[model samples]
Target chain A: MIRSKIPLRTLAVLASPALLLPVAAADDYRDYRAEAMAMVKRDFQAKGIAGLDRLEQDGVQAVCNRTGNHPPADVVRRLEQDQMASVRFPADGKLMGDWKEGEKLAQNGRGFTWTDKPGLPVGGNCYNCHQISPKEGSYGTVGPSLYLFGKKRGYGEDIQKYVYSKIYNAKAYNLCSEMPRFGYIGALQEQQIRHLVALLLDPESPVNQ
Target chain B: MRARFILAATAGIALAMPVLAQTGASADFQKFRDVMEEDNPAELFEARGEAYWKTPSGPKHASLEQCDLGLGPGVVAGAYVQMPRYFADVDKVMDAESRVVHCMVTLQGLTYEAVTRQPFSNQSGTPAHVNVVTYVAGQSRNMPIAVPQRHPKEREMYQIGKEIFNFRAGPYDFACATCHGTDGKRIRMQDLPNLTRPEGAIKAVQGWPGYRMTGGLMLTSQWRMNDCFRQQRFPEPKYLSDTVTAILTYQAVNAKGQIYRGPGIKR
Candidate 1:
C-alpha cells in the first residue's frame, strides 16, 4: 500500500532532494536509553507491518540500545551467541544465488514501513551503508566499503557460509551493529541472502571487479 | 560490469549536501526558495486565516476573538513564538495548531474531529486549520522564539519531546536521530541541522509553517511533526496529541532565541 509510512516515506523522499534546513534531534549523549524506550513505545503506533512488536526490543536490540549501541564485551559475546543460534540456514547445502538478484535487493530500500504492502519484497538497502560496487557513484559511509569482498577475503565455502550467516543476522557477529538483521527478521529469505552473498563473493560479480 | 551499474543506482540513497553554487539541483532549489520568499502563496492562508478568525460562522455563530494564545484573548501578534505552552483550561501544552483547534471547538462550536479532519493540505485544497495556522504564524514573523517552560506541564512536555526526538524505532531503525541527530549529514542536497543542539535546532525549527515549493502547500509545525513520524513508519499521531505538542515544545524551546521567521519558503 505504501500509505502507512506517509510521514517517514515523505521525509525520505523529500530528503533525496529535500531541504528542511537540516536539524538534529539531540542527545543520547547520556544513557537515558531506557527512559527513551518507554516514551518511544508510548508515542508511536504500530500499524500494519509496523506492529508494536517491532518496538519491543529483542535481546540484541535491548543490549545495543540500552548502552547506546555499545554493550560490554562479555554481554556482547553472550548475546551474539544467542543471536547466532536464531539464524535458520537453508535446509539444503546450497548457499549461493544469483548476484544480479542480490544487487537488486542491495539497491532497494523499500519495505518494513507500515505503509508497504505486506508480503511484498523488502530490500537490503545495502548501499545506504556500504560501497559494495565501484560502478555506483553515491554510497553511504555508515559501514565499511565491500568493493572487493571475494578478492580481499578469498573465495571459499567458509567465506560463503560466513557471508550468508552474517546477512541473516548481523548482530550475531557484531552485537550492536547499525545494520539491520535482514535474514533474522525475515526481511530476506535464504535465497535472497544467497544472492546477496553472491553479490559480494561471486568472482564474476562487479563487486569483485 | 560493476562499472555501469553504479550509475543507475547512484540515486539510491539521498545523502550528502553540496552548496547552491556547487551543484545544479542546489542552485535550482536556492533560486526557488528565494523567489517563493519574495512572493509566497502561503501569505494567502494568512489572509484567509485572519478572516476566519474575525468572521463569526460556527454553530455558536461567534468569532475566535475570545481565543487566548497565552497572551490574553484574541491577541495574535507575537503569540506564536511562545507556543507549545501549557494551557490551564485544557490542562496540557499546545502548539499553535492545538490552540486553534481548541478555539474552533470552544468558540466556533465545531467538533474536535471536524476541526481536525483533513489536517494536512494536498494539491486539491488547504485544511481549515492550516489557514488559521498560517494566519497565526504570520502574525509572529520576525519575532524571537520564546516558547515557555514555566508551567510544570510545559516543562514535562519539553523533556518528553526531547526523548521523543531521540527515540529510535521502525523497520529502518530510524529515530529522528538517525537522520537529524548528527551534524554535517544530508539526504541529498538538503542540509540537516543537528536538532539536539540549540544552534542546529533553531535553523531547522525556524522554517516551519512554511510554504513547500514542490506542492505549494503551507505547512505548520504540527504537519512537520506529523510528517517526520510518518517517515519514521510510526502510527499516525492524533491531531494535537500531547506527544505531538511535546515534540514541538522540544524543538521550539531549543529555538527559543532565534527569530521566528516563517511562514517560510522551503524546497
Candidate 2:
C-alpha cells in the first residue's frame, strides 16, 4: 500500500535530506533542497555537449550549498585561505598580458553552453556581473564596477598580484563571491588571465583612462 | 503535359503567397509598436517612484523632493529623457543612476558607498537604492530624449562612446555594432535593437533601469552597459563612471526625438 502511494524514486528523493544533517541545520530547508535536487537530477538528461557529471557537486560547491551564501566567518576565512594556496602564479613572475586580447575576453559571454564543444575554451562572462569598459552601453551590475580599476587601485606590484589572484580564484578573496574562478576551473588559461590583468591594470588601457 | 505544368505553377503561387504575406506582416512594426503602447509597466513603477520621492527615508529622515538633477532643484518630470549629461556641480557627466546617487548622497546624506553597495537587485527584494532609481526613471517616462550635448565635455564623451561602440576586438571578433549596428537581427527569439537608429535607441535606452524578468533584478542603464561588455568579453566597466555616462549620452543623443518610455520591462 505504501509502495503504491509513493514511487520508489520519490522515496529515495525524500530520504536524501537526512544525508545533509551533520553539515547544515536540521531545518526543513536542507530537506526541501535535497528533494528538489533529486527531482532535478532525475529530469535532467545529458545530451550532446552536456554530461551527467555536471550534476555532481564539488567540495567548494557542496560547502556553498550547505551554508547558503553567508557561511560562518571563520569557516569562510579557512576556506578562502585554502583556496588562496591553490593560485598558480607564472613561473617567470610575469602577470601582465595584452590588454587588447584581455578586452576581447572580457566582452565575450559565449561558450560553455550545451551547444558548445567540450574542448573549446569557455568565456569569462565577466560583464554579466561587472562594468568593464566605458564604451559598452549594456552591462549587468552584480559585481563591483571595474572601470578605472587600475587607476583607482594604482598600477603597482601589489595591484598586479591582487588582480592576478582575483581572476585566478575570486573565492580566495571573498569566500562566497559571485565571481567565477576563471583560472581555477581552467575556464581561462594563465596567459588569458594575465592579459585580463593587463586590461584592468595597464595605464594605457581604457580602464585606467 | 501542358496542363500538369500549369497546375504545378498555380500550386507554387499558392504556397508562396503565405510566405509573402508573412514578410509583409513584419515589414512594418505596427503590431510591435501597438504592443508597446498598450500598457507599459514602467509607468506603474514610475508612479510608485513618485510616491517614494515625496516620502522621507534614511538617517536624516529627509525626502528627495528638494534634490536637484541638473535641471535645477526639485524637478522630477522628464529628467530621465535627458540624462548622462554633464553636471557643473559634480564637474563630471553622470548617467541617470550615478546622478541619482549624487543627489541621494548630497540631499539625503546617504553615502555613495552605501548607495552603490547594493545598487540594484537581481532578485525581488526592494534593496533601497533600486527603489530610488525606479522612482526617478519613472518620472521621465513618455518624455522625448534630449540629453544635453552643448558642453565640450559632453561632446567628447559622446565621441568616446561612439568609438567604443564600433571598436571591434575579441575571440569572436565582435563589437556592439556587429550585432546591433544593422536592422533586423535577432538572437533566438529576442530581437536585438539597432542602437544607432532613433527608434532602436529609444526602445533600448528607455527600457533600461528596468526590471529584468529573467534575472529577477531591477537593473540600471549602467548595469545594462556592464553586462553588454561582459558578454562581449571586454573588461568590466566602472559603475556610473565618466565612461558609462559617455556611452549613455551617445545612446540618448542618438535616440533624440523618440519619446522616452522606460524603465520598461524586459524578458
Candidate 3:
C-alpha cells in the first residue's frame, strides 16, 4: 500500500508540469506583440531619409492599433479634434496656390520613400486614390472622383476652407482616413497644399470647365 | 529635291511598319478574358471573408449573422454587384463598403469612427473589416450588375456623377474621359478601359474594392476614385462623401446587365 501511494504522488507531480505548459504558451502569445515591437526597436536602423522615429506611434495610431481602427465614438471625436488642432494655416491667409504646380505634384507620386533624399518635396500621391484630371489614363480609384470639385461644390469661402483643411489633415475629418495628412506631418508645405486646393476649387481651372 | 523627298517617304514607311506590327501583336495579347477564366484570387478573399462574417467579434461578443447587406437585411448574396444603391434607412445611397460600415454600426453597435478610421488592413487585423469587405464583394462575383436607378435619389446621383466624370481641369487639361473615353489606350503595358461602354465600365468598376498587388493594399471603390483624382492632380476626395457615391452610381448604372466579379486582385 505504501509503494502504491508513492506512485500516485509522483504521478500527481508529473501531471502538474503538463498543466503549466498551456499557461506558458498562452503567456507567450499575449506578449508576442510586445516582443515583436522590442525586436523592431532593436533591429531597425534609421538611415538618412528614413528615421527610426517613423516607427513611433502617435496618439491616433496607438488608439487605432489598440481598437483595430474601430475606436468608440467619443474617442474618435476626441482624437480627431486633437488632429484638427495640429493643423496650422498659412500666416499670409492665402489658401490657393498655382494649379499648374499642383498638377505636377499630384502626378509625381515620388519622394518620402527610403530612396528619396530628405528636404525634397514629397508627392501628394493623390492620383493613387482619386480621378482628378480627365487626361491621365492611369489613375487609381481608392477615393472618389473630384473631376468637377469646384463646379459642384461651388467655389465659396466655405468650400475653400474645407478643401484646405481636408488636404492639410484628412484625419481631422475621418480619424482613420486612408488619405495621407499632407500638411499635418509637413510632408507637404502650406504653399503646396494651397496649390492642391486651387487645383480642385479654382473655377478658372479646367476641373470646373 | 525629288530624290530626297522619295528617300524620306521610304524611311517613314520603314519606321511605321514595325510600329504597326507591334501594335497589332499587343492588341492580340490584350485579351484579359482568357486570364480571368483560369482562377481569380478574389475568390480566396471571398472565402476568408465568409469565415469572418460568421465569426463572433466586437466587445459585445457576437457574430454578424444578423447584419443586413441591402437585400432586405441579413441577405449578403449578390448584394455587392448592385451597390452604391439607395438605402432608405440611411436616407442616402451607399456602396458595398459603406453599407458594411452601416451594418457594423447599426447591428454590431460599433462606432462609425472605429469602422471607418483605419485602412482595411489595420481595421481587419486577425478578424478584420477587410475580410468582411472581401467576403461581401465576393458574393456578387459573376452576378450581372443591376444598379437600382429607379429611385429619384439614385437618378440624381447618376447625373451628378456623370457631370463629375466629364469635368476636366488642371494643367494637364484632364477629365475622367481623357484616359478612359477612347476604346484603345494604355499606359506602359496597362490597358485603359473605356468606361463609356457597358463592357468596359463593368470590367473597370467590378474589379475595384480589390487587392492592389503593387501597393499590397486592399482598396475599396471609394479609394479607387480618390486615387484617380490624385493622379489628375486634383485635391483628394472626402471619405464616404456624396461625390464619391455619385461617381459609383454612375459607373454601376452604366454597367447594368454586366456580371459582377470583383473585390478582384489587381496589379
> Per-residue CA lDDT of candidate 1, range A48-145, in tens?
66666556544444444445566556666666776688788889878889999989988887776667788857878888767888887556655678
- What is the TM-score, restricted to chain A, for candidate 1? 0.80
TM-scores for every predicted model: 0.79, 0.51, 0.51
Tens-place lDDT per residue, model 3, A1-209, is 01111123323433343223233545324433343344334533444455555555455544544443566676677667776776888898888888878888888777654445657488877776577877664565546778989989898878888899988878789876656667766678888989899889888777677
Interface RMSD after interface superposition, each candidate: 3.9, 18.4, 18.8
Candidate 2: segments with Cα more than 4 A from true spot: A1-209, B1-44
Docking class of 1: incorrect
- As for candidate 1, its interface RMSD to one decimal place is 3.9
Best by TM-score: 1
Candidate 3, residues B238-262: lDDT per residue as tens digits? Answer: 5666767777887888888988866
Comparing 1 with 3 on lDDT, the higher-scoring candidate is 1
Instruction: Show where candidate 3 strays beyond 4 Å.
Output: A1-209, B1-37, B122-127
Error of 1 at B126 (Å): 1.5
